[model samples]
Target chain A: MTDWQAFFIALLQGATELFPVSSLGHAVVVPALLHWAFRQADPSFVPFLTLLHLGTATALVILYWRDWLGIVKGFVRGAVRGRIEAENERLAMLLLAGTIPGGLIGFLLERPLKALFATPRVAALFLILNGAILLTAEALRRRSERRDLSREEQEQQFKSAQQITFKAAFVTGGAQALALLPGISRSGVTICGGLLAGLRHQEAARFSFLLATPIIAAAGLLEVPQLFSQRGPLALYAAAAVVAGLAAYISARFLIRYFRAGRLDPYGWYCAAFGLLALILLR
Target chain B: METRGNPALAGVVAALGALFVIISALYAFGAVSFATSDPGAAHHYKHALVALAIAVACLVAANVVRPKAA
Candidate 1:
């Protein structure tokens, strides 16, 4: 792959990786639309892309080091004391539960999903459908309430991670499995699932990010072996990966703050516009 | 809490918005082409390097400038 291709793909990886829109969908669709020479089976291209994902996963870990550190510290302390701390122990268990569904689903279907990744047009169609999912989710959140509480009151209800239940986490995990398809946004779907479970927007977004940590790491671990089989200039790929990681980290920081204070409507609108554009252009 | 506007914070936000725009434009335009011709290759690589350099410079500047909180 050329340096330019690496840079663009890295940028795409960084931006869409955080945005509710699907990054994988963009990765698959953009190259196909442009008729780029790198095929899905190209050894150099696959390794190069895998390294970019590693960069993104690294960025997520660095960006959320505090959360991950808390889980680890909590687990170790609980083990030493032979009693679980409620907050820390609950968090650790929640993460474990959230990861199980996707891990199982992905392992069983990895080969078939790999085949789906090669179909850009199908991914594009799914991207549009993913937008519809987000839109419907937002509407559903607007309609439901615990009782007769007002909209603002309802929004204030689930402000923290403590409010999320074990059932909600499992549902979010199942939603994450949809990410196996290219156009489905892992973060978007999980956050939507959280909203459907009656969690507030910021709370949903936070849970989505926390939940994404392990999954992204697992994806990198699976791809690392394949990356080692390639014969490209490893240094250049490493440099690009570092650049992508830093970009992703900065993007994640901005997004967390944005989701906290901003409404999801803008992201919804963006997905709609992009999905429509993809349909038109790809057609 | 005090609600005064901070010029440095404003600058940081403005800088971030600009960075977002540049990156979005690059993706929208397919400016990182990897076509197999010499000119196409040069165009693609040059754009990538420029974007990487700009992104890194902006990040460093954001860190060093210590934008005062509003």
Candidate 2:
């Protein structure tokens, strides 16, 4: 890939990966829509993307280092004491439960999914579906809010990730697994799942980001050797990764604050419009 | 307050952990293959890490579920 292409792809990876938009979809479809020549099927592509994912994961880890530290301590403490009594321990276990479905599904079916639907056209179509999914989730959440629960009743709902049940986490993980599809967004679906599970937008976004770290890191960790292998331009790739990491860190910071009072409506509309535009242009 | 814990379930989870670690070893040794694309030594090592992580998680989970009072 050309240096500019690599840089642009890295920027796209960083920002969209955190945004409710599908980064993979953009990575796949944008090139085709713009008539960029690099083939997604090129042997070096997956490893390059994996490296970018690693960069984004690193950004997330840095952003949530305090939470991760607490989670690790709690996990160890829970294991030794044979009880998940603390909030940190519970959050750790919740993340474990939340990671399982996506990890397993990605491990087992990622290749097949890519083989079947990796085409830019298909990704574009799924992007529209992703938009619909996001809008529907917001509508449902609004409907639920209209129920007019008393202050005490609203206070009883899950306010933080730690307060959620394991079952909720498992189902949210299932939502994450849906991102295996080319155009689906991991953060989008997980935030929707969290919303359904009673978390407000900010907390849902926070939990979604946390749940994403391990999966992204694992994908990168598994392929680190390939990233350093002799076939690609290692120096250029490293530069792109740094770009991606910085973009992701900034995006995560922005999204955290935005979701505190913002809704998914704008992103949903953008996905729908972009998907439709890509569909027409690519055709 | 004392809470109920299932030791038997913990044992089962621990067994699963052992099985995954064994599978990880097999991958590391190149004793197994998946039906998809051709993989190199790095691929095998990568999968081995995945299995090892899973095994570790399971082992920890087993401990978390084991009866503390027993």
Taking the tens digit of each residue's C-alpha lDDT, what string does model 2 give over B1-70? 2256678978987897898899888878887755336654444777677778878877887777677764
What would the per-residue lDDT of candidate 1 be over residues B1-70, giving only the tens digit for each residue?
1123335744773486367447635633566443212334324432343344334433332332343343
Candidate 1 Cα errors over 4 Å, as ranges: A40-43, A76-84, A145-154, B1-70
CA lDDT, every model vs. true structure: 0.68, 0.83
By summed lDDT, the worst window of 10 consecutive residues in model 1 chain A runs over A76-85
Model 2's CAPRI class is: acceptable
lDDT by residue for model 2 (A8-115), tens: 999999999999999988988999988898876677786778779888999999999999999889878876776887889889888887886677677668877878
Off by over 4 Å in 2: A146-158, B1-16, B39-43
Number of the top-ranking candidate, with TM-score as the measure: 2
- For each model, chain A TM-score? 0.89, 0.94
Kindly report which residue pairs in candidate 2 clash with one another.
Answer: none
User: What TM-score does chain A of model 2 get?
Assistant: 0.94
